[model samples]
Target: MTDSLGQQKPVNIKALLQACRSKEETFKALVTLSKTLPRLSAEKKTEENKVKGCESAVWLVVEESHGIRHFKADSDAKLMRGVLVAILSLVEGKMLADIQKMDLKAELAELNLSSYLTSSRTNGVLAILNKINTV
Candidate 1:
C-alpha cells in the first residue's frame, strides 16, 4: 500500500533526508511533512508511550513481524511530530540486526541536524533511539 507521501510503498527515507541541502530546508520539509503524516490516537499518547526527555510530549510504538520492525509515533507539538516522523522513517520496517547496526547519530550529523536542535531535543531524540534499539 502507498503511504501518505504518494511515492511507493517502499520509500528511501535516508535519501529523502540527504536531499535536503541545509537545516532550513529540512525544517521547511518538516512543516510540509507534518501536514501529511498520520498521527497516533489520544489513547496511544499516554504516559507509558511518552518519550522521557522530550520538552513536548512524544510517543512511539514498535511492532515486529517475522523480522521487520514497524514504528508508529506521535507528538503534541507539530514540529516535534514532524521530527518524530522523520526519525521513524529511518528505522521503520528494519530488522533487529540492521536497527542495532545503524548509526543514527552519524546520519543526523550528515543531515546537519544537531546544529539546529537544542540540547533537550537532542537528548529526546537519543532517548527515542535508545528505546527503538532495545525493542
Candidate 2:
C-alpha cells in the first residue's frame, strides 16, 4: 500500500490526550460539558438531528439568537462528546459571521487534539461543522 501511494504518511509523535489526562479530570470535564450542553430533549434525538457521517450517535440542534447561532450537540461516545464541546465552545456566543470565519481545524489542532482523532472522527468533526454552517 505504501509503495502504491509512493510515500508513507509522516507519523505524529504527540502523546494521546487520554494518555496525559487523568481519568478523574476527563470524567469531571465530561460531566461539566455534558451538563452545559444546550438542552436537547430525548424526543429531539430523532434522525433529523443526527449528524450523518459520525460513527457515534451524534445529535446537533441550533438556535439563532439575533444573528448569533447557539449550537447544542451530544454524542453517545465520550470522546465525541468532548470533541463537540471543544468545537461548540468556540461558536457558542459568537456571531454567525465569526463562526463562518473561524478556522476550527487550526483551533483544534493548536489544542493538540487533531492528532488524537482517527480519520473517521475527523470526518465526523467536519460533518458536525458542516451542519452548523448550513443551518
Candidate 3:
C-alpha cells in the first residue's frame, strides 16, 4: 500500500512474522512497528475518537478516500498501540466489504498474540474491530 507520503510498501505483517523465530522477537518487531505508526495529536484524540472497552485510553479516526478506508489511531499503552497498528495494517486502505470479509481473529491468532492478552485486552481488540466496521 502507498502511504500518505506516496511511498509504496507491503504491510510488514508477513515478513515480521516470518523473521521472528521466537515470541520475544515477534513482540520486539511489533513494538518497533507501533513506534512508527501515525499518531493523533492531543487535539485529535478527543472523546469523539475514544474507543470503549480498552483499559487504556484508545482513540481512532477513519477517513475514506476513493472507497478505501484510512485509519489514524493511538493508545495510552504501548502494547495496545502496537496491537492497534497491527490491526490497522490489515484493514486500512481497503474497501469496507474487503475488511469485513477478513477473519481478523484468526489472523491475529496466527501472530500468537491472543493467548498472551488478558480478557479485557481481547475485548478491546474486538471493540476496535467493531468500531472499524461501523466506519
Ranking by TM-score: 3, 1, 2
Cα lDDT of model 3 by residue, 1-135, tens digit: 446623223345655655677768878866876786767899989988999888889999988999988888999888787777777777778899898998888877766575447898888888998999886
**What TM-score does candidate 3 reach?**
0.86
TM-score per candidate: 0.82, 0.72, 0.86
What RMSD, rounded to one decimal, does every model reach? 2.9, 12.5, 2.4
lDDT of 2 by residue, 1-135 (tens): 111212111121112233436555545544444544444689878899999998889999887879867676778887677667667765666687787798867766744464447899888888988888777
Poorest stretch of ten by lDDT in candidate 2: 1-10
Clashing pairs in 3: none
Q: For residues 85-117, what per-residue lDDT tens digits would candidate 1 score against the true structure?
A: 667666777898998999977765654456557
Name the runs in model 2 displaced over 4 angstroms: 1-39
The top-ranked prediction according to lDDT is 3
Output the worst ten-in-a-row residue range by lDDT, candidate 1.
1-10
Q: Please report the candidate that would top TM-score against the real structure.
A: 3
Per-residue lDDT, model 2, residue 39, is 47
